[model samples]
Target: MNSTGVVLSAGDWRLVLDPHRGGMVRALTRRGQDILRPMPEGADAPFDSACFPLAPYANRIAGGRFTWEGQAHVLAPNAPGQKHPLHGTAWLGNWSVETGEADRATLLHHHAAGPDWNWAFTLRQHFRLTADGLEARLELTNTDDSAMPAGLGFHPWFTRRGVSAIAFTAKAVWLADAEMLPTVRATADTLGDWKQGAALERPDLVDHCYAGWTGQLRIERGDGDIVLEGEDTPYLHLYVPPGQDFFCAEPQSTMPDAVNREAPAPLLPGETRTVTMRIRSA
Candidate 1:
């Protein structure tokens, strides 16, 4: 069997993963209908996949610069035409399959200390398909002898064609500047209530992080509703590009430039942190 390409299936749910291509979920379907945007066959870019894991950190780190333990560290932009290092190295690094079965698979990635991060770490991602939905778990462990700042998240691209409404509760939302960095935080009352729900159609491009998220989101589509639940994720980054066929409802542990914000939790040597997400259709 090709370890690079693995599929997990349970009941009507099927999930395809590419461990060599940033360990991304190439496709996710329920009864042959895509629950997430399906990547074309042979696609190697993680950005084009149905979902991907974010580890060591999530989102961007302003200008690829951060100071940890009084030492300045710099990271080169991993994505083309972008100034900041995006997501994390886990999505761009090769992952080795540690175990697999008919309905579940686990992949592992180890990072050595480099100029970009300046610390070593190990990341593990597990994908499992249940009768009604999918569950994903990510764990990050600091392997270096010193403490390191870390964050975890999952970026999932959902089909936006028939999405009618989105509902979630957040205390505040971060407004970004032209460079996509947080400029100001607006309260829900001022920004508008997503808790009661809001129309998916919006006039402006939506790419911002909602702080103090309730870790629950509902997407109402023409065929059915997709419910997302996260464990220990306090932030949600919503990316809805106008005139696009896909949108992302990312469950994140921190906002963009989290390292500059000093928001990520510090992991001591040999310490591990984990995050889990569940997606269900109704």
Candidate 2:
């Protein structure tokens, strides 16, 4: 499952994982039809992958800066042309295949204390093919001698070439400023009307983290419907870049810049946190 990754198959589903390229899913398909926007041949950037793991923390830390326990820390922005250190650091590092099989695989990434992030930890990503659909799990463990801040999530880009409707219920959405940092929490009434569902087609960029998620949602596609549900995940993040043929409905544990807002409770030494994402046909 390390890059020169493996393809997991079950029924009509097929999953391609590139563990070396930031533990990305190169492709995910059902009956040869793309489920998510697939990574094109020869492309190596994780940004182009079908999906990827977001760990240690979910989204950005304002200006790659935050103060935890009275100590200020700065993380270099990891994404291109972006000033914030978005999507955590795991997406920028390679993972080793800890275990691999025909239908499931677990990849491991160990992060050492550094300027980007202090506190060491291990993140294990497990991918399994099931009769219903695909199941992905992210398990993060605090290996540091002291406590560490941790969060889990996954960023999957669904194919948006045609009409794809989305639906999920949330109490509110965190509105951001020019830097994409949260500035306001507004009622879901004025948002995309997600409670009823809406097509993925839009004219401008839509990036925001929603609060009070119900832990489930559905993507309506022409060929079939994709239902995604998360276990113990309270927040949801959506990204829809204008004029792009791909869209993301991420399941995360914390808000985009939670460290800047209500910081996550520290993970005690030797403690582990896990989150599961399940995809099924509806």
- Indicate the residue-level lDDT of 213 in model 1: 92
Q: Give a tens-digit lDDT track for model 2, residues 4-85.
A: 4688999889999996759899998888888889998889898989999998888788888888888888889888898888
TM-score, predicted candidate 1 vs. hidden true structure:
0.96
Off by over 4 Å in 2: 1-4
TM-score of each: 0.96, 0.96
Give, for candidate 2, the lowest lDDT window spanning 10 residues.
1-10
For all candidates, the clash counts are 0, 0
Report, for every candidate in turn, its global Cα lDDT versus the true structure.
Answer: 0.87, 0.86
Q: Each candidate's root-mean-square deviation in Å?
A: 1.5, 1.4
Give per-residue lDDT, candidate 1, residue 134. Answer: 97
